[model samples]
Target: MASTDSHSCVVYLVDPQDGKKGTVVPDRFRRLAIADGCGVVGLESADEDGGSQEELTGLIVAAIAAVMERQDPAELGGDGRAKVGAVAKQAGFKVTKVQFDEAWPKYVDGLGADDEDKDGE
Candidate 1:
């Protein structure tokens, strides 16, 4: 589910705790700090995109779908969780993993994956 939505903008999301110690940041715009996805790779991920971008764009798509559905991608089951862990190492998300058989689904198990699950995987 690569999005060719030409109408787009990058938004930087910062955890409040990561702010300068005691510094006050006025509520501002929201942004995505990702690159190598769909179209337009941000400068942030430019240096890191040295041939390791497999499924990175799909990861972004899945993540967006999860948020839209109010589902936490990390807590998803089967294929969803498998895909999440696959990109965790590269995407820099500190998540735990189980065995391979457990990580992936037994079959193609389409449908749910049509919502970007398999593509993301």
Candidate 2:
């Protein structure tokens, strides 16, 4: 999992290999930050080495769609998590954990002010 703006925005990427995880984020999967609100937008790409990047991408997209189509917003979170898990299971790729806090500390600090406020109270 990768977080930006102090963990307000996070992105998760699952590798279609051994499932090893890393959290330094790139611009590609930035849309995942919206997962809690409007749902996440996922994009997947695979190399020609029998990797299931395409499949995984499709699964993520489908998951997002499934979550968005839910009648209640409260259900979106659970549905999204389920969809992500499904994609990982169906695709032969391992998921990479990326975090913006480690990648962009300044950004995270700035974004996390709200968290600080909540914690302070």
Candidate 3:
């Protein structure tokens, strides 16, 4: 998340109480915010090439899938998490492992049973 200052804008899942923000907010939250008519605050970053929500979502998913594809699930450990973070960055999102871990559950839950079953959950 970028520093909260006069110029900085809040993204999707900003906790209002503390004013904490995340740039790579989960799609579920983003959609709800928009559907509820909440204003979206976007920051202009020199590194970021602004993109459509669908495109960005595809990029993020592809990055994760690519990393998972190269590793056996049983063998994936801390290194796997690191690889995911790196892959996300390569795809243009500055995602950390902790952030990914936190947001992933929300993203998964939003998909519900159909997606979960596909994952053998």
Residue 37 of model 2 has an lDDT of 23
The residue-level lDDT of candidate 2 at 40 comes to 25
| Per-model CA lDDT versus the true structure | 0.36, 0.38, 0.49
What TM-scores do the predictions have?
A: 0.20, 0.25, 0.30
* Candidate 1 colliding pairs: 11-30, 11-31, 11-32, 12-31
| Segments in model 2 whose C-alpha atoms lie over 4 Å from true places | 1-46, 49-51, 77-121
Q: Per-residue lDDT for 1-121 in model 1, tens only?
A: 1223334443323335665322222222111222322222333454545322323334444443443355555545654543444434333332234322322332223336575865786
Q: For model 1, what is the alpha-carbon lDDT of residue 46?
A: 47
- Top of the candidates by TM-score: 3
Give the range where candidate 3 is weakest over 10 consecutive residues by summed lDDT: 1-10
Best first by TM-score, ranked: 3, 2, 1
RMSD of model 3, in Å?
13.0
Q: After superposition, how far is residue 29 of candidate 3 from its true place, in Å?
A: 27
Question: Residues 45-112, candidate 2, lDDT per residue (tens digit)?
Answer: 34342233333344444444344345344443452332333333332233332321122233335447
Best by lDDT: 3
